[model samples]
Target: MSEREVLELLRENARYGTDDIARITGLDEDDVEATIAALEEAGVVRGYQAVVDWDELEDERVRAVVELNVTLDRETGYADIASRLARFPEVTALRLVSGDYDFDMEVEGDSIREVSRFVSEKVAPVPEITQTVTHYVMTAYKENGIEFGDGDEDDRLSYSP
Candidate 1:
């Protein structure tokens, strides 16, 4: 429970030092440090990353969500294909998901043409991949449980069914 609480705090802000975490969680500073170390060793805490609002940057990379349907290989399976896809520097994230597609992929490039080329040249050529539908990310309002942009005023309408 304590570990979960610590993780939640870290998720909110990865920059939280031991003293801050200890203060927030009401745990001793030394214990907080030890717990974090243990979590990292256990791979419970994979990595700390800064969530940047790429739209704010003048030179932002083009992003897209690609839905891919695949025919799974008997011997190799998902692990091998997923590994192959992940090696590409353009691939931001990939997941084997349930629904219309076998894989949900996030990729980035300098332009839409670059991403298209990657799909045509790199991804589609794989024997297992049958079809791919790409959806370009126009804007990211929220990600990783954190809302993007400054204004917090709720714009959602309330209704009863």
Candidate 2:
């Protein structure tokens, strides 16, 4: 099997062993192992992760997407401010976006108040940050290409004729 095929199989299921991948792809087990090692070394395969349904857990959490408009530094631009924002524990994801906002960030906290506090107290105080808009996530139907709940059921009630 080609390297691309091996990568595809690994992407579908990161836990697949070398023997399992070799059997499916019709390649030798050692070849599969070597290809995976090469991919990891090259930084193509960053790390394996389990997608957890955080909503189902006993402790409730709040997630919010924050849009930030910032004054860019003449020398470093958004990179300096973005790197500083990334260091916050509450920030799960940060991206330099193209549009009305300079940066889009995903953050999680114990409650709405906590998320608001982070934005107001922490993010707002940054010298470069001019404005921020926070949108809290209410429900997650799907995440990371995986469905969260029953696939067959519709959210709306069936109508009676």
Candidate 3:
């Protein structure tokens, strides 16, 4: 199997061992192991993480998407600003985008107040940041291509007035 196939299989299920991947992809177990090791060494595969449903847990957590409009510096531009934003522990994802906003940031905290504080005290205070609009996530039906709750509904109850 091609390297792309191996990568795809791993992406679908990170827990797949060399033997399992080799068996499924029709590649030798040694080759599969070597390919994975090479991918890791070359930085093609960065890291593995489990997708957790934080909402289901007892701990209270809040997630917010903050859109930022910024004045880009002539010398370094958005990279410098984006790198600075990425250093914050609360920031899960950060991207420089086109159109209305210059940057999009995803932040998580223990509470709504904590998220608000991050925007006010940390993000908003940056010199390059001109404007910010924060939107808090209410309910997550799907995340990272995985459906959060039960499968699609099949039947609906009807009532006559």
Best by TM-score: 1
TM-score against truth, every candidate? 0.90, 0.84, 0.89
All candidates' lDDT scores? 0.91, 0.90, 0.90
Query: Residue 81: error of model 1 in Å?
Result: 1.0
Please write out the lDDT profile of model 1 over residues 10-65, one tens digit for every residue: 99899988899999989999989889999999999999898878898999689999
In candidate 3, what are the lDDT values of residues 1-104, reduced to their tens digit?
46888899888889999899999989999999999988899999999888777779999889999999998767768889999999999999999888899899
TM-score of 3: 0.89
**Selected candidate, larger lDDT, 1 vs 3:** 1
Question: Per-residue error at 148 for model 2, in Å?
Answer: 1.4
Model 3 worst lDDT run, 10 consecutive residues: 152-161
lDDT of 3 at 5: 87
lDDT of 1 at 124: 91
